[model samples]
Target: MIEFDHVSKHYPGGNEALTNLSLEIRHGELLVLAGHSGAGKSTLLKLIAALEAPTAGRVLVNGLDVGRMRRSQVPYLRRSLGLVMQEHRLLMDRTVFDNVMLPLTISSQPPSDAAKRVRVALERVGLAEFENAMPITLSGGEQQRVAIARAIVNRPSILIADEPTAHLDPAYAREIAALFRSFHAAGVTLILATHDDTLYSPYGARRVELAHGKLLS
Candidate 1:
């Protein structure tokens, strides 16, 4: 379980992203964050992964305080999470397999074990045959899939995506949506922030709207 207890995030230069917001997300819930740009949707997601700290209040994940975790603990916290941020951030020079394997390279897992896991992740994303392909060669939607594969290579229990279906055509968007659904069906805690009504409105199990950093509903 994750809880945001009266959380407020104030950036440098007096910009407040969130204001005394409190929310609770149970495990394995498909929660969608709905809002216009700058509504603090991304900020809310960042707090979960501890990419940003709250100026006031606490964010607790399974009884561990996110805001107060040490640097060494942050990596462990993130290992339990799969993140697909807006940017693909894939290395243009790297092969698809290499991109997915990057996460495991930091661990004590052996090369053979890591390689098998990478292959499994690629297979799940339906890109097993494209492991040798370069990111520069794939289409936008395929590139997004690669990013998703990289995120899940760690076998994270919780998945967070920011605008997962953005910038894709209708068919491609639908495909990606279905992919996310499969993950949810497999019992991964899915938290997605999207402005696309097709995704957040009729798609997610629960929808929470935000406006100017406050929950609207």
Candidate 2:
């Protein structure tokens, strides 16, 4: 479980990205953070990922406080969380298999084990056939799938996605949502930050809606 205790983000320019926010997310829940641009959805995700620290309050994951964790422990904390971005930040020069294998490589896993895990991840994302293909060879949706595969390949307990389906068509967007549902069913806690109404309105999942940095509903 994750808890947000009066979290807030204040910038050097005096802008407040998040304002005394507090919420709780149960494990194995598909929680969607719905909001417009600059509505603090991304800010919330960054805090959860520990990419940015909260100016006030605390973020706790499974009873561990993120802000108090030592610098050396930050990477290990992050390794337990899967983060997916809107852009596929794939190394265009590398094959899909290699891209999915990057995390295991960074963690010092043996090449043989990494290869086995990468293949399973690619197959799960329905990109097993494109394992040898470069990022440029795949469609935008396909590349996004590769990104999702990479995020889950590490078997993180929590998954956070920021605007993951922004570049896809309606059909592909729905497909991605379905894929998230599948992951959620498999017991991974999922949090998605997005502005797409098609994803939230008539919403099927638990949601925290924000507007202008304030919780709206």
Error of 1 at 32 (Å): 0.3
RMSD vs true structure, all candidates: 1.2, 1.4
- Candidate 1 — which pairs collide? none
* Per-residue lDDT of model 2, residues 3-120, tens digit only: 9999888878998999988899998888888878999998899888788889999999899888777889889888888889988799999999989998898889889888999999
Residues 1-217 of candidate 1: C-alpha lDDT, one tens digit per residue? 8899999999999888999999999999999888899999999999999999889999998899999999889989988899998888999999999999988997667899999999999999899999999999999999999999999899888999999887888888888778888898899988999876565456557888999999997
Tell me the spans in candidate 1 whose CA falls farther than 4 Å from its real position. 200-204
The per-candidate count of clashes, in order, stands at 0, 0
- Give the clashing pairs for model 2: none
Model 1 / residue 78 / CA error / Å: 1.1
Off by over 4 Å in 2: 200-204
